[model samples]
Target chain A: MRGKYLLGILVILGALGYMVFGGLGRNLVYFLTPSEYLQDQARYQNRSVRLGGLVKPGTVQYDKDRLELRFVLTDGVAEVPVLHKGTPPGMFKEGQGVVVEGRFQEGVFQGTNLLVKHSEAYQAPKEGWTPEEVRKLIEEAQ
Target chain B: MLKTQTPSRPDALTWVFLGLGLLLLPLGLYLALAAPPDVNQGYLVRIMYLHVPTAWVGYLAFFVTFLYSLLYLFRQDPRHDRVALASAEIGLVFMGLALVTGMLWARPTWGVYWTWEPRLTTTAILFAVYLGYFLLRGAIEDPELRRKAAAAVGVLGFLNVPISYMSVKWWRSLHQTQSIDLTTGRIHMDPAMLQALLFNLLVFTLLYLGFTRFRAMVAALEEAKEEA
Candidate 1:
């Protein structure tokens, strides 16, 4: 009876171990910054990657008819072009940080999905601030 | 004056804990459904009040089982075994609730009730592992062997909790990433939503504590009967 119980325990644990480690190993893609993926370009090429960065200002171009969005994602130090085949989400805009999951192609991140990488505290864009106004405020504070 | 209270009867507080929980259920539902819709998620977000707490409290209950199981192993006490079983039962109940609520939430948001998405799949696996613990416990008739086998499972099954939580980060999943940051220990929801979620969390937690206490007392009575 003791031996039988031990065997039963082993069978269940074995099956579970396979599911946890094995399933995770096969499906997981190393989440990376644009700079990290750029650093090891060859190794990460043609592989699924979750690239996170800010949406660079003025690089956002959307075609409403085609439901296509093209933008440059920048991490201050590095930038990658992203092309996504979907209507821009309501909160999606320049200067917001986002994570794009896709494969690298011909120097572009062909994004399959765009997710705000963190809590979307910026529900509505602030109304007053602009480039020049922000610059003047910062200069005065300085 | 010498007549004493009956040993079979539990104190008033136990009943009070249970009554409060039962009474609060409707209020919890009202608060959950009546809260303002989220900016992005809309009405679908109301599920968070129930789903999030169920998952969190389920993990906490399993953690209790793990603690008692470890103690049982070291101390060789039947009391610890009883506590572990009681905790697992409640944990299973909440886990089932989380799964159902999760499915209901997922269908409208993700376009499917079930997905191979890492977090959803991992949560399913967690449910299976704990259910296996109960099955193992039933299979063994010898109380000594039963406690030992069940304890072993209670310890091993806990390894799934962290994996279930981290799957959203470790792999590609449609599920939203964690809103409550554990490292910095800050919640990332709007203050109103946070309040509703926390309120329900507190009510559910007290309910869980009270329910488990009553369950453990019943187990003690059963053990006493076997000895008698």
Candidate 2:
């Protein structure tokens, strides 16, 4: 009886293991810096990829009416123009480090998700001190 | 039915752990909430004091479950199975807290409540796996069979833990990588913020220790009662 039960358990485990490990290749989206993504443009085009880089200074443009955001992502060596359809995250700003996830298409990275990667250093507001004075407290903190 | 063995009771060490948790947890919370705001994150960062620590402890709890489950399999000891159950119960609660807290943190910072990011999705899967473990236990009535099956799950569920931790690194997760790196001994934070986070980690670790011990004793008493 124990042997029979053991065989059942083994078969069940084999199936579960196959599902998890087998699906990993399709499920995992690779993270790449801007340069890396550019280095292999053909491989990533039309495929979901996370492009990590700094938000190029003076490159962020937002249309509040349409909720469309456009920015340039740079790894200092290469820059990719990203067009996103959403409100930028709280910490997003020019010169901020960010990662955009979407597909590279027609000379632009069309982003479906936008995330700001904040600096590790915890610094205080430079001049104005207000838990209230800020328009959007979350955005200003950055 | 007469009792043959004394039901387990928490010993002095349990008291010590409980005492330390009671003492330091509040202090840690005070430091976390009342502490100065981060330059970049401001008041929103307070969530980390709770969110990060709960996640750390939650992961630790599941790790305990995994360890005890492996031990139970090796020795075929019901005592180890009991320990695994106790730890997993605590772990489940911690994981819930981590998920909820992460959601709360995401709203203000990420500009949205939830996303299908790798870290979040993997963690949700982990949460389901552990929940399934408890359900699996209840579904099996034969003690030995139940123990064998649950132990397998208890071990397999642990595979998600490492994946969750490394998700931010392996994939481009919106969730940031861990602030404190135990592997390289690198901590990313201001002194005060790091201090509060470290204190909370300590308190939560003690709390996990004490809570798991109390839970195991209760499990032992339950088994004794069932036998009697």
Q: What's the CA RMSD for each of the models?
A: 8.0, 4.6
**lDDT score, residue A140, model 1?**
48
lDDT of each: 0.76, 0.80
Worst 10 residues of 1 chain B by lDDT: B1-10
Residues A60-98, candidate 1, lDDT per residue (tens digit)? 998889988999999999999999998765446678667
Docking class of 1: incorrect
| Model 2 stretches astray by more than 4 angstroms | A1-24, A30-50, A102-106, A119-142, B1-16
lDDT of 1 at B32: 75
**Top-scoring candidate (DockQ):** 2
Task: Please provide, for model 2 over A1-142, each residue's C-alpha lDDT reduced to its tens digit, 9 standing for 90 to 100.
Answer: 5555455555545544554565444446535888888888888767888788899998889999999999899999998999999887777878887877799778999998887766545644445566555435655444
Which tens-of-lDDT digit does each residue in B166-192 have in candidate 1?
877777566767777665576667676
**Leading candidate by TM-score:** 2
What stretches of model 1 exceed 4 Å from their correct place? A1-15, A26-30, A62-65, A86-97, A114-116, A120-142, B1-13, B33-45, B99-128, B159-191, B213-228
- What are the TM-scores, per candidate, against the unseen true structure? 0.70, 0.81
In terms of TM-score, how similar is model 2 to the real structure?
Answer: 0.81
